[model samples]
Target: MLPPASQFRAQQKRLDQFEALTGIKTTYSYVPYGQLLDKITTEAVGGSSEYDLFSFQDSWMASLVGYLNPLDASIAADKLDMGRYPEVFREACIVGGKTYGLPIRAHPQLLFYRKDLLGEVGAKVPASWSDMVATAGAIQNKSGISGVALDYVKGSGFQNLWLWFNCLWGHGSDLFDAAGQPRFNDAAGVAGTQAYVDVLLKDKVANPGSSQFNEYDMVNSMAQGKSAMIMVWWWTYSVLTGDRSRLKPEQVGFAPMVRFNGGKSPTLATLMPFGISKQSRHKAAAWEYLKWVSNPDLEVEIVCDKSDPQTSDIVATQTATYLNDKVNAVNHGLHRVALESLKGARILPKLTIWPEVASVLETTISEIVAVGKPVKPSLDDAAAQVARIARRSGRHRS
Candidate 1:
């Protein structure tokens, strides 16, 4: 689990409970996000892992598919209700018509802003990307703060590209066509890319340092009152309202991510699934652990636990966790807002070669943002590179 500090402690408590209830000893390891994919893949593919169960990002599904045990039989035998999970989250755990894992943590993007700043300027929450630019500008003019802080830092895998994808989707374009050919070099793609860049370069609304900012940096900027707004994962809500934060809870406001002027808003879902290793010698034991960890009741308890009583864990599975009144009352209705945002949420392309493809696109975006390269030529070159990768991987028939 790439847990926040509070969540890390909360998860530890749950693991202790799981061990006491089942008499199965459990140990936890914290792996940094940048190194997790390589570590999990290397150990699983080698068929001699130290761990029986592992959690992996949804985007790594296609690459790790070969080394994971299919959970269909286990789910059927246990009578687990897969229907309880959001379709977007449940679908992320499936590959080639088989269920490979269960989603334990799901995150959706949200536009978080300082309501006090917006109110002072008489600026409404932004409904479109253009509106966001205007609102941000208004807030900056009134407050003399950066209008937004975004995760634009390069080399952190796909965080930068995910923002670009939001813009791409909002413009009625995508990374690839149904035939799996690269399509992000088209006019819509160029427009989306330009809009994303202009937020920092031309509009001068986002923090200048945002060019090197990741999620944490953006969250810190908002929490410390350096920036007025940010579009980030839902989990950061805990940090913004937690005891360590510098701002009061009432200062922050949340909304779904911005869309194009006439387009429906679309947000990206980042899911983490728990899977049992195919090579595990203790398959049955591992299955039991997976079942316990994903049980809906347990999920609710973990998220709504009153130990802290202020911050809440964002559970990905189980509809009740998001809609239950008790849960929302404690967490300031974060779950309800997240559930609404999930209506427009989607996962990235499920391909084993996506990491490589994403790297190409990430570089293009960085070049455009950092060096002021023209969007068209950069996207064109990136499209060519991604098409080559797709062809090599047999994902692009054309």
Candidate 2:
């Protein structure tokens, strides 16, 4: 399974060619990213006659396990040779003592900055939120563009949704505890976010269009020099810095996401995973394909190997060994520094109503920033709605 038509045809073609040469007939389906997960689940529940394996987000592992083939648990991880991939990436696939899916790819968010703009202002790259503000101001003072952009729109499924959450998360805030309580409604979380919003609406140091830009738009802005610095996942490095015609690769640089004034640098992780349907006639064959596509040789060569023209992304495994220390001499961070942030990174709050809860949070954020409501009251209402959604979702208790 893969993304819908326009974006997925190339992948389909690549797989089809591989199958024909190997004489291995395989079942594959393509759907829009928005509809893909639901279609995958529905096909699973009804029957896998039409589809075999399903692709899903990594964070949905727990949900996928209940329905999909317990692939690795059915087969030992060591037997599958987990050593070659990152350890943490392998661990993510194992749920309830069983392995579900092979990791496809992994790329953590990284900091981005423009050398020419920063040099003219003589201001250093911003790390702390306060510094981000100052840097934006300085950049604007010198360049006439907003300093920073944080997503304050509705719909948490988008990158800015996650970006906004990172702000609170980086400052030691979380949406919920393991007990699934609404901890993010606390004073610091609310107060910290208030400042976050004030920067966008009051200070206006962000792009007028940032509220609408997804992960790609931000990175593209940086490549075009519309914005000085963009905080995005590792893929941006490959995409933005690869072409000299667009922006010289040397003009861009990366660093770990910065620290808050009183906070340590946040290392954060989120997931995008895949799982098979409970209703697949081709579960075994699909698993076979997944194994091949996700094998270290393929993933590393296509994704992490910068020197290779096919190199596209970082490895999905969490282990440090998976990283290439000096691919084309890129300043790849070898440290497990992000491990702490991943540990601290908040997972989506437990709610079967996640789709709805995400919508409410996004709308509430839009109102706070777009409508100019008092940040705290808007948060209180959002927390209330989220609690209500939790009760409705039936996954969270008390």
Candidate 3:
């Protein structure tokens, strides 16, 4: 599991407790995500015992799904019991006609706003793209507060590309064609890009520094009431609930994205996937490890981690974590309701290439928006580069 340091320690404590209870001995170590994935890949491909169980960001599921063995029978035959799990998360394991992972954290994106500020402005929370734009402008024009914080810092322009792409996909546009080809230059994509860009450029509804502000900035901005609203993932609820001691918890609120500019869009559910290596002689132990790590008790610890790690594991099926009292107290109006909204969320491409392709597209977003270049040509260039990446990786683009 690739959580921050505090999370690793607390989870380690729980895992240690689990081993004693189950009488199944095991050991674990922590490393950076890139280092861990690289080591595991080398071992799995080389057919060596490089690792056993793994937890990773959702994007890699499509690529690794083909390489790992199915666990449906493992659970069905009593090696583990699937019935005890939340169905939503359990299904995320089944990708490309195979069961490859479990949900360690269910990552869902949401729109966070200042309920008090909206009331002071006599404005209602936006429920559509048109409404969101208008809301942003209204807040900025009237309150001198940016309507929405740009959550794009740390290559946020890069992160925005993927989140924006999800909105595009939900709006009936595809960044790429079915054969793993890039179509970001297509009319729908161009239109989507224009609409997304308009929020920052034409509409002035978002923070001007959004291009430079990463999630940390968004956290500080929103937590301190700098921005009236922000779109962010589920786990942010932790830091968002606290402020610089001056701001009380009552300042924040959460809500599902009202709608894309087109009226409605798909809800995207991002998950951290759990997997067992094909190279493990302890396949049974690894499977048991997944079951143990993901048990409701342990999963809740991951979600509502009271630890300093802030590693809330938002498992695939557990929206209950969305209803924490502390989170609700910070922003009562939207937290739980927004959590329930996750049930209808959609998963993006599970292919391994998405990580690289997404990175390419994100890097291009700032370039396109900065130079006043049109999205179509920029996307075209992005697509070609992504295709070349796929070819070089020794796999065809999906």
Q: Total clashing residue pairs per candidate?
A: 0, 17, 10
What tens digits encode model 3's per-residue C-alpha lDDT throughout 1-398? 35344445556767777787777776666667556566556666788765677666666677666457677787668655554434555566777666787666566677777777788778887777678788888878888989887644335424665457655765577756777666767777777777777788788788877767666786677777678887777556656775452345576667776566454466666666668877677888787777777665565455454445344433334444455565444434344665555544666666677778778877777766666667778878887898898778766544
Candidate 3 deviant stretches above 4 angstroms: 5-8, 43-50, 79-91, 152-158, 243-246, 261-263, 301-316, 319-335, 387-398
**Model 2 lDDT tens row, 1-398:** 76542212334445775586555676556677778668766766675556667666666565556677777653464367766644555666666677777665455556677777778888776666677777888998788866665555555365545666666765566776677766666886786677667776777788776766666666677777677777766556656676632778777766566556464634455555566666677666666676666554444334333453442344444344334554323335522433433433434432345566667777877777777788778878888888877777675666
Candidate 1 has an lDDT of 0.82
Clashing residue pairs, backbone N/CA/C < 3 A, model 1: none
Give the distance in Å from residue 124's predicted Cα in candidate 3 to where it truly belongs.
Answer: 1.5
Cα displacement (Å) at residue 42, model 2: 2.7
Model 2 regions lying over 4 Å from their true place? 4-23, 81-98, 242-246, 261-267, 304-322, 326-351
Let me know the TM-score candidate 2 reaches against the reference structure. 0.82
Task: Indicate the worst ten consecutive residues by lDDT in candidate 1.
Answer: 1-10
Measured on C-alpha atoms, candidate 2 has an lDDT of: 0.62
Question: What lDDT score belongs to each candidate, Candidate 1 first?
Answer: 0.82, 0.62, 0.66
Listed in order, each prediction's TM-score against the native is 0.93, 0.82, 0.84
For model 2, where is the 10-residue window of minimal lDDT? 4-13
